[model samples]
Structures are given as structure tokens and as C-alpha cells.
Target: MTSHNRRKVRLITALAVGTSLLGLAACSSGLTAAPSDSSAMSSPKAGGNLRVGIVGGSAKDSLDAHSPVTHPDQARVIQLYDTLVSYDNDHKVQMALADKVTPSADATTWTVHLRAGLKFSDGKPITAEDVLFTFKRITDPASPMATATSLATLKRDEMTAPDAQTAVFTFSAPFATFPDIAAQYAAGIVPTGYDPKKPVSSGPFVLESFSPGQQSVFVKNPNYWRAGQPYLDKVTIIDFPDDTARVNALLGGQVDAIDQLPLGQVNVVKANPAIKVLESSTGSWLPFTMRVDQEPFNDPKVRQAFRLIVDRKQMVDQVLGGHGTVGNDMYAPLDACYPNNVPQRNQDIAKAKSLLAEAGKSNLSVDLVTSSAAAGLVESAQVFAEQAKAAGVTVNVKKVDPGEFYGDQYLKRTFSQDFWFTRDYLPQTSNSGFANSPYNETHWDDKAWSDLVAKAQATTDEAARCDLIKAAQEIEFDRGGYIIWGFPNSVDAHSASVNGLTPDKSGIPLTSYGFRNAWLAQ
Candidate 1:
């Protein structure tokens, strides 16, 4: 094996153990280790259209970034819209649409400068007014953007575009991680008068034709600000909700690449000499949430009991096929700002039963709702159910359709399974699934946790922010309702002829994988 591949395997092995040991030897664990950059693997040739297949998409998909979450929606949105900032393959934040991001002296205000001479695909001049509109739309109560809660601190009136190039954002409280929040996919910039029915975007590629579940086509934007980028003349994305069909399409050269490759099929993809497997660890995690506001789970003892019974190492090894690292009930596994001081929670059936007995529910029979909608949830749920039996807990697994899983079944179920994408910032992770946030699956709201997040958000000192986050994570480790057992490594398979596709551990296919930056070797 090459020295880089050997080093990567060693790091993954170390991460499996290091996460269980409270981040020991994990500072640089999987963060620095990455797959070989395909861009560097071959000379760039930009002409042919690339055909990409993806799992987890349906006919109901739309261009609306907030509603109808699907793989195709995610893959297609980046082609049409651009976030202010996005993480590179190495998980480092880089400018996309915004030229400069700066903070005020008190950290309560932020200023953003737009790149000059930028234009939407429709030839409309891109300006700071568009940035303000994007933010205001998400924060608007009637909007479907899930990121509204993240911007709750900043009032719409506090945002201003003094001129076409400059925009200012004033927050009710200090927000040191504003740039990270701006990097979210949901924060994609749209025109000041954006109409979902008729989309206007400023990304590398412009939407040519969209046919929901069947296919979508994008042509290179001639007016794109980044000169000579989007090497392909055209890009085509097909919806392949069926895993087998997606793999078959890639093997048959029906498509140039595929995303969201299931772990069970990794061997099958690798067996094809014409195909190459690219893997990277990103913000991807599969976790089960127990609603703290509901019965049986309302009792802290029951929550603790559940945490004590599941074996994280077994989940990583068996379900993920050792393609992932252990999780500590918290997200942002790759972000350097994540707290590492919390004591790692391990499985103990005896202690779990004792806690259940103390909670007066010695014979607990609960239902676990998981769906095939997200990869590995059903398998992980089955494994977790088997492991929980040792603690005298009877778990019933209910699997549902992947289509309805995200929108209908996931957060609605009391004890449910779901998958989370990578978020580079700690605050973005926290806001999406913690405290009183709308998507808080577990319904866990604690003053101490919320206070720490607020303080950490406001604190500019890196040391102080880390300390506060560590303390908050400790509280969640002891009492949070999330069972974050494993962080799955993302695997994308593509034809050998395809080049410049950067595999990212952050798991964001569009920005992190450098899809726009990728070129087809003609």
C-alpha cells in the first residue's frame, strides 16, 4: 500500500479507539487524513458533460433549499445557488460568493463584502442586497428554511446593505461563529426577489432543465465569477433511489459517478476494475434520539439506561464495516472546536438494568423507529436492539420508506433513527439538533446547556470558547437524549476516467467534494 493509504488506515484505527478514550491521540486523527485528490491524480481537461447518480431522491423534489430534503435536492442546489462560504475538501472554510467576512470589536456585529462583477445566471448583478434577502427569507416566520432558529438572535431590521458591495449584520448578542453559520448550505445566497417557482442563481452551473425524480440538467454558467471554473460544459444529475440500480448504472458506465454509496456495496463497487472507490470521514453520523419530553424517556434514569446499553465500538465495526469512527453523543466530529473533555460513555448492561430498575421501569419494552430512507439506520437499529436485550429492555424495530423518513417519520417518532450531514461549525451543529431548536429531535432543552452555547457563541477567545463547549458537552453526555454511536465515513464511487472529484470527510458532496472544481478527463 502507498504510505498515504497506510497512514489513513492507521488513523481510522486510532480514531475508533481514540474516540472511546475521550479524544486522546485524536487531535489530528481523521481530520488531516484524506483520500488522494483526484484533481492532482490527472491533468485537468474540461469539456464533456458528467453524469452523476445519487441515492435518496424522489419525484417530489424541488429547488427550495429548506423544504423537501433529499439527496438530489442537496446535489442540485449547489449547481444553482452558492453559500457565502463553504468548507474545502480539508474542512477549511474558504470564500465562495463573499469576498471578505469580518467581525466588529465587540463581536456583536459582522460585515460582509461581496465579490465584484458577479452576476446571476440571468445576468442580474449580484450584490449585498441579495445577501440580506437570503437571511431575511430564512428568518421569516412563514419560510420553510430549517435554519431560521439559528438566526433568531439577529433581527431582520439589524441587517443592512449600505451599498451594493457592503452588508452589515448586527446581532442582539455577540456571535463569534457567524462565519461558520454563514457557511451552511441553507444559507445559500439568492436574488433579492427570489421566486421558488422561477429560480435565479449565481453558482458555477445554471439549471437548464429539472424533471423532479427522473433527472436534472445544468450547463456551465458563462457569467460565473470564478473564471475558467466548472470545467464541464454541462452536468447531468439523475435520481437513483435504488442502491442496486445506482451501483449498476455506475458499473455499466451509465453514469460517471454516484454519491451516498451504501457500505454493504463498497466491496461490489471496488470489485469493478473500471470503477474507483473514494472514501472520506465527514460530519456524517447515525444517531437514535429518545424524546426527553415523552414518557419512559422523560425520566433521566431511563435515558441513562439507554446510553449504558448500546456499544459504540460494536456499532462502528459491525454496522459501518469499520468505515467509521465512534461518536460521543455529540456532532461535529471533524471540527477542531468540538469539546473533547467529556468522559466517553460505554456499554454496561448491568448498570443499565440497575438504572432502569431505579427508574421503576425494570421491564421496559420500547419501540425504535428507523427507516431505510437513510443508509445504515435499519442495520444499526437492529444491532442496537440486540445489544439492548442484555439490559432487559425489549426494543422493537420499525423501518419505514426513505422518502417519508426525513419529512414525516424521523422527528415525529418518540424513539427514532436519523442521519445527520456534516456541519463544520459547532454552533450550526448545536442549533440544528439541540436546546429549543425546531429540529431538536430529542426535545432536550436545558438552561445550562443553552447558556453555555450562548456564551460560547459570544466569546471570541478560542480557549474560553473551547472550555465552555467542553462543559456544555459534559452536561449533554450525562443527560442528553441523543445516542450518537457512530460517525460514518462517506464513500463515493466513480468511473476511473472521471477526475478532480475531491473526497471530503465533511460529507458535503457539492462544496466539499469540489464538484464545480472537478473536471472530466477527455
Candidate 2:
């Protein structure tokens, strides 16, 4: 057996200490009747359909994991497919369908071995062909997925499968984050010739039915590779684009849980004695991007002036309700490579006015477009416009429907509100949001900054890599398109009876790391 298999064998062996293969029981209902004993409550019993609601759902939701744009679409991808690798609750890499991921000495080559006897939901063996196909599809230029840009370093020609169980990747240069890239939802593994709309999942659950802008249902996968898992028999994901409606669903017990709990309604949930509130720090941020290619914002001093006038603390306190940390322009907090030493940018209207004067724009009227796509986003924009008045600028606020924000308003406007979900890898976050990335909404392209990011990616030494990343972040902090004001903690609410739900800041709450591990209390 290979080293990866050996490690998995050891883990399975450790688990064998308590229960035999047949000792694990199965259930067929949404909730099974637990024994009268209180001890039964502490242990997970198989059974129950979990009904979950999420914010920001629309008819445009994509079943294709590689191209999902909204929060609900992202959450559904996690339920319907498994990545080559995945992260644990603490954001550490953990083996999933992939039994092992070994990198070469220079980090240019990576070898992936799938677990033995792995099978898709349709009972076909999951092999190297599937893994390679996933990479090729994600990197395809025509693909609308953000991952196409995120995995740009990967070359299709260098990807090969030596055997049915083994997949190999050879990069032109050292790319230490290949594993991180592989683990992302966009790179989720699917069977060869798999169809996104009617996907056959190898994950803990199988998609039963889907209704656009309505709800999607998933039933447990009995043949799932992970034994004795997915205690819940089914998961019903309901769409609620409106915050009040979503929260009301949870409060009325119509749904067991809700994702993206609005900060304004957090107190309302808290008041309910039967609701369990869970919060976790996330790298998620709400930022206003200024298109440097635009007229007034084309001037660097004006951009700097705009950044200086915003009160980040006030936004964090009033908008986030103190459930978040102040952001310093660049994204990726809670990750190891985040540049913590960069001096915090505080509100300075006098300095901003001086910068505006230097830019020959001492008097300016700017239109700030915003949406309610994320909580506090529109409010933050309004507060920022008020704050900029002290810098001798008139800021106009234009509101659009949250649904149309990402599709129409964002990137199309010279200045607009955008929110990014937390990505575990700092380099991935930087590549997706900054460093000449296609998603770099600000259109701030700097060769020197890109060079620094390249160096950081190629560096093998942790300390050296961190230094390079820090330098790149410092450049963005000084003059990037994003004015990151707050890193909000991901907050979710579930019924008091819902068990095993953990806070996840890696993006979508409750489901990003697989909600199959959760069960409804009996």
C-alpha cells in the first residue's frame, strides 16, 4: 500500500477500537426516536432531515461548483460534492476523498492518491480521471468560475494520471499552494463526464431535487466513503434572499437553522430562549472598490484621500455591532500570512483633505453605489459618505437591489460595495482579490506588487514566504482598490435542538465544511 493509504489505514484502525463495521446503525427518517436514557442525547444517532435557510439566493444560482456566485449556491456545492482535500474545523488541511497529497521537494510537483474503494454516488469508482478532469474544467478559460483565475498557475499539459488511483501535477515553477487550490470548492472533484445540474455526488449527501429561487433537497449517501457519517438522512436548503424572512423562518421553527444571520437581527435571535447562536471569526470583509481607471479615482492621491476619510472603528462598532475586527485594506485575516504589522489606517480627514488638495480635487462630488447584498454594506457606504464630508467631498449614495449587485452594479460602477467570503489560504485570497487578478475590481495593476506575489508563491521557506506576502500586502494597503473596513464574524442561528453545529469562518456558515456531520436533536 502507498504512504497515503497507510496513513488512512492507521486512522481507520484507530476508529476500529470501539465499533465493528456492522455495529454502526442506519436510520431512514428526518429524526429517529432516541432511547429514553439521557446518555443517548450525548451520542449521535443516525436519522433526521435538517432544514437550513441561507441569505442571498436567486434564480441565477449555479449548481456548477466552479461557477457559483451567491452564498446559497456556494453552500449547496459543499453539500453536493467533495474537494480533493478539505479543512477541519480549525482551518487545517485534512484528507477527504484524497487519501494523500504529497508535494515534491521544490513544490513544483504534487502527487495525489485517492482512497481505495472510493465510489461516486452512482457506484462508479472515483479515479484519477475524475480528479484531472476537475482541474482541467476549473482552469478552462471559457469557464465563468473565479477559480479559473485562482488556479492560473496550473498548466493542463502538466497534469497526468499515472494509474486509476493516482493523479500527478507538474507545474512549470514551484507553487506551494497547489494543495490549497485543490481544496477549494471550485476545484471540487466530480465523476468523469459529470453534469453540474444533475450531478452525482460522492459526498455525504446526494442531490434529490432542486428548485431555482426556491429550495434544494439532499438525501444521505449510504455508500459514502466516510463510514457511519451523515447522521441526518436529508438536508433541505431553503432560499431566503430577504433577511427578515430568513430569520423569521428559523424563529418560527419552520427551519432548524439559518446561515448569514444579519447583524441587525442578532439581538432578536439572542432574545429567543430556544435559539442557539453560534459565531466564529471569519476572513470575510466588506470593502468599497474604487476603479482606478475611472476619472477622479484615477488619481492615486484621491484614492488615498478616500481611504483616509472612512471611519473603520465606527463601522465595526455600529454596523458589525462589535462582532468583528477592523480591516486594513488588504484581505485575508486569521490566516498565518496576514501582515499584522502593517500600521493600522485610521480616519484622518485633515490628511485626506490635504491629499485631495494635492490631487487638484480639493472639491469633489463622487457617486458611491451600494447594495444590501451584505449586512451593513449600504449602511457602511452611507456612513463613509458622511465621513468624507469632512474631507471637503460630496458623496452621493445610490442603492440597488442586492440580487443585482454582484451581477450588474459591482465592477460596472466606478465605486461600489463588494463583499468577499473568507478564503483559508492567504495567497489564494490575494490572487483572487488583488495582484492583477481579473477579479481585482479596482483595476489597480502594479508590476512591482505582482512580482512580490510571484516571489511569495515560489518561496519554500515559511519565514521568507511570509515576508514576501507581507511586502505585497503593504503595497495594496497603501494603494489598492479596496478600502476594507471590517472583518465580520460569521453568525448563524439554529434551533436549540440542533446538535454538532460548529462555527465556520471559511465562508458559508454551517455548511462550508460539510453539514453532514451535524444531526438534529431528538
Most accurate candidate by lDDT: 2
Tens digits of lDDT, candidate 1, 355-397: 9999999989999987765568888999999998898999999
RMSD of 1: 7.6
Model 2 local distance difference test score: 0.72
Q: After superposition, how far is residue 273 of candidate 1 from its true place, in Å?
A: 1.5
lDDT of each: 0.71, 0.72
List where candidate 1 sits over 4 angstroms from the true fold: 1-38, 66-68, 434-436, 510-514
TM-score of each: 0.89, 0.89
Q: What range of 10 consecutive residues in model 1 has the weakest lDDT sum? A: 1-10
State the weakest 10-residue window (summed lDDT) of model 2.
1-10
